[model samples]
Target: MDDLDRKLNDAFPGYVVRKDLVKQVRGNAAVPSYVLEFLLGQNCATDDEEQIKLGIERVKDILAKHYVQRAEAGAIRSDIKQTGFQRVIDKVSVVLNEKRDAYEATFENLGISRVLVDSDTVKNNRRLLVSGVWCIADLSYSANEAKDESPYLLQKLKPIQMSRFDFEGYAEKRGNFTMDEWIDVLIRSIGLDPSQMGKRAKLFQLTRLVTYCERNYNLIELGPKGTGKSHVYSEFSPHGILISGGEVTPAKLFVNNSTGRIGLVGYWDCVAFDEFAGKNKRPKADIVDIMKNYMANKSFSRGIEQVTAEASMVFVGNTSHDIAYMINFSDLFEDLPTVYHDPAFIDRLHAYIPGWEMDIIRGDMFSSDFGFIVDYLAEALRHTRALDYSELYRDHFELSDTLSTRDKDGIQKTFSGLMKIIFPNKEVTTEEIAEILEFCLEMRKRVKDSLYRIDETFSRVQFAYRPVDGGSWVNVETLEEIDFPGTYHARDLVPLEGESVDEAVIEVAEDHSGTTVQEVSAERVSVPAIEEKTLFEGHKAYRENQRGVSFDGLFGDYLKGARRIEIIDPYIRSFHQCRNLMELLEVALRYFDYKAPSLEVHLVTGPDDYDVAKQRDYLDQIANAMAPLGLDFTYEIDMSGIIHARHLKIDDSWDILLDRGLDIFQKFDSGNAFAIENRMPEMRRVRQFEVTYLKKD
Candidate 1:
């Protein structure tokens, strides 16, 4: 085991399992992750190789013997008839037979129905009434004389869930890991690799967990498909139910007036609508109205009574167009159905996760590392719902005055939810508080900003915040706003400090904003204006997975007239790093005078420790490639290993500090020549980076 794996195993014994084991044991079982992990947690939650191997064998034996497969249902039923009783693991859902006055159970994969269930079992596992719960059940077939009683009997049943959770104990153990480590632990628990993500990206992933832990929280994520938007609600927890967007009805989600019975919202902690963005989808109008009231008030009218439920709501679906197209031609909510397109419904969303900012699901992104058993995590989250950290930030920061009560509430709920997930012990720093508050504020701001584009009647609340101790009001803008500032803010945007709102910005915005960003009902704000991209002499931060950033845009204005450039990046040995160096040269070539004698670009970098020869070869190739374009590229291997600082010095006048050197962009489809990001650097989502331009003495 690696150090982190060892640490996790030592700290959280019997609560975590090697995550990759799920795929190994799950050979087409068609079960949720929590179900599979439940079994694994009982058997393989250990670091010992011998015990894990034996556990895997035992679990495999159990599944082979007891796991019900629909295709083999007849064989299993025949076996039950012969043996008089059979133990099977299957999805069990229950319904009340009004005339018979008895609860009937259906084993989904076992292909058995009309099984008689006792009132005690039905009352104990009420979730079975709302959604199919994966459970181990003892079934016995019976040949009865009564036609209505030709039946199977349910002897016993156990739902696949963590029966007990200690929130205090879990919160206490959290201190063993740092904030970053804890975040990684949670990310791994969700089966994603934290090494491949940045702070912002990690936060985006954690926002998915907020819906589970925070009661009545509303979140929507609309982006391109295959980003795993529905994965969390579907597989991460047993307490959450993922339903098709079109399948929603007032009776299914809220309450049935006919029977006076509660629905999914009353039973499940989280109810998610998958594939929710198709404009053609005709969900019941009543569903939209019900959702509007429930999302806002956390209560819905049932006959003559008010029914309250704490179920969080999530809407996730494929966005038809890219962000640019949606921003220019329509708004981000373009794919939402006409019925749900109301401002009242949209306003209830506490946070709109920019799913486009999420990296697509890749096999490599799944971790083989240790993570908590999902059931444990789910139970912990379920227990944490009772705790409210919404006001935790009041001591550190305050919201903008322009924000409405709804906007502030959204921010508070989102912030509180994140705190519950990340800092369950309620231990946090002022900077950390500011960081999360800003993130949550921007989330709500994204919803608000898109609302403005759809309907200008929505007030332009400055989505900014200030530190309670004293600080300038820090403005929060969605990443889309940063990329497409002009149209993203459709109306005339307040200019940056000292810069006049000029016709030039408007012209640029109009020219660039034509072909991009979503939807249906509101009159879209079509005034496309660009915020000036003028460079400054201070630090500039760029988010990971955020597009519309390029080396040319960043360095063009600064590197325009330089004759000589000195790049000291110690870690330029890898192929991507070499590509970055090459791209920087191209940026310089785009603006520099190629007709000059030669633009000298020299680099001082360390040799690749693993493959020094390949490093030399790459550098030599870069030099050879640049020499022909009247750009003399040279390099020196700083064997002393002291050259760790990365900065660009041009013409001995400007020194630009690069936190990540020229390797700003994340790994992408460079192999696919057709990839637009390969041809246009601005189209690429960058790795989180910061640059500071300073005047050298």
Candidate 2:
């Protein structure tokens, strides 16, 4: 184990199970990951190889003898009859048999029913009434012709869940991990590799868990297929139920008036509808109306009375069109069913997760590292539903007064849910609180901004916030607006009269640290206008997956009219880093005039500790290649080790600070010669980073 893994093991101990072990034990069984992890958590929670091997064998033996497959159900029933009793692992759901005045159990996949269960068992494990529970059950059989009754009997049943979790212990142990480490652990627990995802992408994955923890939190995710949009709701928690969007009815979701029995909302903590988007799929209009009311008020009307439920709503679907197409030709909610296309229904959603930003699930994306046993995490989240951290941000920042009550509520719920997930102890720094607050505000802003385009009556609201300690308001915009300015600022979807939307013009000014800064008007009034050049060099931030960035756009104007340039980046040793330097040189050569004197460039970088000779050779090759282009290149190592800042000094006129130095592009297959990104720097996807332009006056 590496340092983080060892630290996680030391902190979480028995609760941390190797995520890959789930696949090793699940051969052909259709069991969900949580069930398999529960079994593994009991036996193989240690790092000892011998113990893990033994545990694997024991788990295999248990599955072979107990796990009931549908095809083998008949043989298992015969075995039970012959032996008079047998133990099996299957999904067990109980229903009240009014006629017999008893609760009867049904073993799904085992295809057995009418097995009598006691009232205490049903009451203790009430989840059995709605969806079901994976349990280890003992079945007995006895022929009774005189009584005219079936012989199937439920002798004993144990739901496959952690009987008890130490909530205090869990919260206390959270202090041992940094916020990033905890986020990584949570991502791994859900079977994803955190290393493969950006910070925003990881947060998006964790946002799906908010519904599991926050009461009545409504979320919708519509994206391309294979992003694992519905995986968490279906497999991560037992308190949640994932059902087909088309299969839902008012009776199953709200209440059955005939039987007067409460439905899924009464039993489950979260109800998610999979495959929920499609114009052709017909959903009951009445159900949509009731869902909107419940989502807003947390209560649904019953015959002569009103009943409240704490179940959060989730909708996951695949979008048939791309985000740009949807934004230009239609609204983001275009794919939803006609009944759910109402503005009121759309407004109730607290957050809209941009599914298209996620990468498709690849084989390497599954982590083999240690993570919390999902059952433990599930219960931990469920326990946090009662805790509220919505007001935590008020200590540091204040939301704009222009926001409506509904908008404020949506933002608060989202912020509260994220705080519960990341800072359940209610202990956070001001910077940490700001990060989450801005993310929450942006999510709700995405929903509200789209609403304005869809219905012009909905006036635009400034989604800005101010620091309580005193500072200018920090305006937040959806990353979509930054990346796709043309589509986001289309003239047809203009803002309301008397309201001005600030169009951020990103200009690369020559400065010490070439940072991009927005030029805001004194009245805070502007209009949305698309500019050809989007890259700025003064003082601005860029989100991950944002496009329209190139080397020329970032440094072209800054490097102009300069005879000498000094590149001071320490990470210019690796082959990829050298390639980035070479790309920058190419950009410089293209930017400078051939008629001008030779442009001199000097690199002040750290040498490779392991292979200095190879690094020198690469630099020499670059120098040699650029010699014919009227560019003089030379290098010097920083033996002082004090040159930590990554900035470029151009003839004492501008200082450009590069947060990621020259290594901004994400890793790609350089072996593929035909790849366009390999030849064109602008076509490559960049890592999340920031650049600052400081004037050297």
All models, RMSD in angstroms: 5.5, 5.8
**For candidate 2, which ten residues in a row score worst on lDDT?**
504-513
lDDT per residue for candidate 2 within 1-697, as digits (tens), equals: 6677788889888888888999999999999899999899999898777988998888888999999999999999999999999999999988888878988888998898877898899889998887689999988998777453458888899999989988898888889889998899899899999988888888899899999889999999999999999999889988888997645989999999999988899999999999999989887788888898999999998899999999999999999998767765577888988888878998999999999888788798999988888998999999999888898999899998889888898899999999988887777899999999999998898888778766656766778888988888888888777765445533243334665644333221222124433443322234668766443548866677666677887888877667899999988998989988998998898878778979999999997888988999999999999999899999987767777889888888888989888888766667799987777766666778899988877
Please report, in order, the local distance difference test score of every candidate based on alpha carbons: 0.86, 0.85
Tens-digit lDDT track for model 1 on 639-684? 9989878999999788999998888887787889999989998888
lDDT of candidate model 2 versus the reference: 0.85
Model 1 lowest lDDT segment of ten? 503-512
